[model samples]
Target: MKTLAIIDYGMGNLHSVSKAVELVAPDTRVLVTSDPAQIREADRVILPGVGAIRDCMAEILRLGVDDLVREVSADRPLLGICVGMQALMSRSEENGWVDCINLFPSEVRFFGNHLKEGDVRLKVPHMGWNEVYQTTDHPVWHNIPDGDRFYFVHSYYAEAEGNPDIAGRTHYGIDIAAAVARDNIFAVQFHPEKSHRAGLQLLKNFVQWTGA
Candidate 1:
């Protein structure tokens, strides 16, 4: 059986993400664990998270999931979701300034206390559905259409203006890095588990992808 490990660093929505993965790929074994051995041995790895980058990074490092994620990402298909995606960056503007794993050379920036679109004021969290524009072609974008809406619940997003690794972009009050892809690593600022159809399709694509 193909094993897919979702790193449980005490920050992610582990149950929902594992269930969604199971729903998309029933044949694949999904493990929600912090065990380094299981993570390394799995065919695929998923890093899913919610909440602040500081707390997330603390638990990740404490559990040694940071190293395990990096190790697995080097060889197998690894998917990061929500704050999990933010954790892959070099730094986050949240909680003053916290350093991240730096898997991708980027920074997580806050949407700002006072954001606006034209005349209307926008919320900081940027909750609910928003369209994601595909910046580049990728296997993860398989059947997922460009300009499709995905569920977002974040106040901070990875900067994507000139980053070459960025695969997708979205807008609220600013340009948000919706997705980033490099070799075997694919990370998203949105939660696929809660994103409905298009999100499920993206997860399915990841399940079948060979990281090519």
Candidate 2:
């Protein structure tokens, strides 16, 4: 069985993500790894996190996993979840705005903390199920239905600076980024593992996607 490394950056919900992948990709070995060298050699890599963007970046950098992330992202199939997804952006304003992994040309900012900010009725960090609308034509959403409900638990949102590597979107207060892709790197702002059956299906589809 080909091994898939779920990075143990100590910044993500590693146990749940590892279990989800193993459930869907049964034949494949899902190894929760902290060793950068092992991570580099894995068939596929998952960067999962649920925390501040700055802290996530710090953990990766301190562990030197950022370099491995850069290396793998350049040549392999990589899946980044939630804050991991935001980390791929050019910059984030979580702690006074700082540089990120730069896998995509986008910026991350916290949801406007206003209950009466125009169409933004939901609370900031938009918790719970939200419908995602595909932003571009990609193989990942090949069989996935449009406007599919996905579980979300985030305080910040991503906005593409240019044409952007956007893959899908979800409306909250206003339209917000739901997913994005750039070459071999793909990510989602929501937690597919926690989204129920469709979430599991997303994991299944990703395991068998073939990076096509």
Candidate 3:
């Protein structure tokens, strides 16, 4: 049986993410845990988190999940969600600059208090559904179409800065890296569990992906 580990380091919507993965891939064994052994043994690893980047990184380091994530992501399929995604960057502008795992050569930045689009003021968190435009071909985009709306509830987003590894982009007063992929890792700034159809399809694709 296929094993999928959802890393739980005192952050993230663990149960909901576990349920969503179970819903899409019922036959797979899902383990939501912080144990390094279990995470290392799983066929696939999912790094999920919510809340401030500072607290997220603190827990990740405190639980030794930082090195674990780096080790597992070296040659296994790994998915990061929300703050989990931001944690893959070099640093985040949130909480007055917190260092991340640096899996991707990018930085997390705030939406700004004066964010606006054509004379209309936008919110800080950028909460709600927004269209994600596919920038590169990837297995996770298999059944998902370009410009499909995904659920987002983040004030900070990854600034890929024209990185070739960027897989998806979305506009919310400014362009944001919605997804990033490289080698065996795929991370997203949106919550696929709350994204409905498109989200589920993405998870399904991730479950079946071989990281080729």
User: lDDT (0-100) at residue 153 of candidate 2?
Assistant: 97
Q: Tens digit of lDDT per residue, candidate 3, span 83-175?
A: 999999999999999999998888888889999999999988789999999998899999898999999999999875677678999988888
Error of 1 at 190 (Å): 0.6
Candidate lDDT (C-alpha), each? 0.92, 0.84, 0.93
Of candidates 3 and 2, the better by TM-score:
3
lDDT of model 1 at residue 173? 79
- Using all chains and alpha carbons, the TM-scores for the candidates as numbered come to 0.98, 0.94, 0.98
Q: Per-residue lDDT for 1-212 in model 2, tens only?
A: 78789999899999899889888889998999998778988888899988888789898788887778888877778898999998888899898997888878888987766744576366766789989998888766767799989999998889733436788988776677899988887799999889877788888877776663
Better of 1 and 2 by TM-score: 1
Q: Over all chains combined, what TM-score does candidate 3 have?
A: 0.98
Cα deviation in Å at residue 175, candidate 2? 1.1
Q: How many backbone clashes does candidate 1 have?
A: 0
Residue 156 lDDT (model 3): 92
Model 1: how far residue 44 lies from native, Å: 0.6
Off by over 4 Å in 3: none
